[model samples]
Target: MLFIKTFTRSICTGKYSFAAEKSLLAALRKKTGYTFANCKKALEMHDNDLNRAELWLKSQAQALGWSKATKLEGRHTAQGLIGVAVNQYSGVMVEVNCETDFVARNKEFQSMVEDATKCCLRYIESQQKPQENVAKFSLDTEQLKGLHSENDGKSLADKLALMIGTVGENATLKQGLGLKTCEGIHLVGYAHPAGHVENGLQLGKLGGLLAYRSLGEGNDHIEIAKGICQHIVGMRPTKIGNNDDKPAPNKDEETCLIHQEYLLDDSVTVKELLEQNQLEIVDFKRLECGEIVSSIGKQPLEFVETCQ
Candidate 1:
């Protein structure tokens, strides 16, 4: 009778005498990247079972992520990272935004951006055909969010929610782009303030893709291609300048890429450099994390539009 009374009291008071509280909490936290407090709650809710605690935490995390995202979408998200993935035939860029630069610099946040960019690139590679235009295709956020990963079969939105839960911030996949080149064109990309490279993805504040058609034997100038991409990222030109438009003295008004001075030398114009190398610009794209569209009035020859 005394033992039964003690058990009833312990259960009623929510004070189960679990011997592995610390170990269980630590294991669940490691597995799910959840807070210790939440892990403890899950452990308690599930009778001190680590696997059950992890499952509960993940399920709650998904729900919590959406709630946090919806609540925080109204908050300004001006800081984030730009990630790029590219190959010889195609390239892709994706921007993921967060409310704070502190979150933007987080390694996990950067990894999520990288994964999204890579997924977009894979989509481009799979969807692109020989007849496709030589310009850029704007990837819709919803479609991108719906793309299922081959590894785990989870949609991007699902993974993004997980990230949101982990980061505890209002994160958004603001923009995505996939660029394709024509038969004669070559594609190259560069990330400003060259960041740490991982698995061929570039993560940084600004990124640019430059497409050029070799006019002669100059299509494969390694240094020249990289230099041009770097220049595009730094200079922020909107259009390809006319051939007659020569470089003027500090012509800040000249936003055309060809007329802009070479970023590597600055002694000669980009036009001059291209001519010397027998290269002609096919198209180019630059991406920043949270640029205001209304601010860029001087538009490129063709702006990337939403995919139809």
Candidate 2:
């Protein structure tokens, strides 16, 4: 009778223990997106404390991410997404690259891009130059990664590395644009092929940020600015050339913004629409994911020339 009671208690305890471990494994996997094996390792390391296990897993992921980043550095990252954020007075644009379109569409990957853009937006807010009504600057890759993420206190580099580990891919911050505008300047941005919005930030294949001032009392300048941005994203103009620039014979007149036909109204050019609205573009930036950059050799500070 004594032996039977002891055996029954042991069996019940074993079943309870197994149940607890199964629950912990499932919970940890859901929380951290780590594999079952990793979660089990974390649970064992931390005695099944969920929060502590999560922390340990994330800390361990940093090393994994760094290793993957180094291993995949030379791989051609031909696909990625563009993240652009615009608040009332300032905005930011960023391009984050990965090896495959499959990885580019990953939620974790998109989250990293969102965090990066938000970090840059905060940096732009801090570096506001009230003297310049409109300013455009490129972001240094190292500096951006060193900055703390706005969502969490983790350094952007660590966050990025953790993501690299999680997704098992080489992700890179190819380029970033920090934009600030004065109160009166209408700063707007548009994204083509935009995905779902998260905390006001959107990811897309192509993005455009535009800052312009209304020379006259234009009531609909906001809409006009957005329309121009849409046009900029669609047209891919190289310069804000004057109306006097000649069209290049047969190839659609697209070398300059002022020369391109207004997307909103095909009857008139962008210059004509601007003239009608009494608007002058202060500065603008168009970012397409993975576009070739001939002038990319220059440092961020070297590309700091401000436009009015």
Best by TM-score: 2
lDDT for each of the candidates?
A: 0.77, 0.82
Write one digit per residue (lDDT tens) for candidate 2, span 1-308.
99999999999999999998999899899988888888999999899999999999887888888887788777788698888898877788888889999999898999888888888888887775556577667775676777797566898888878888788888887778867777777788888887757666878999999988889974778888889999999988888886577866754856788888888888998989999889998888898888886554247533253664
True-vs-predicted CA distance for residue 47, candidate 1, Å: 7.6
RMSD in order of candidates = 6.1, 2.7
TM-score of each: 0.79, 0.87
Off by over 4 Å in 2: 1-17, 216-219, 243-251, 302-308
Which numbered prediction scores highest in lDDT against the true structure? 2
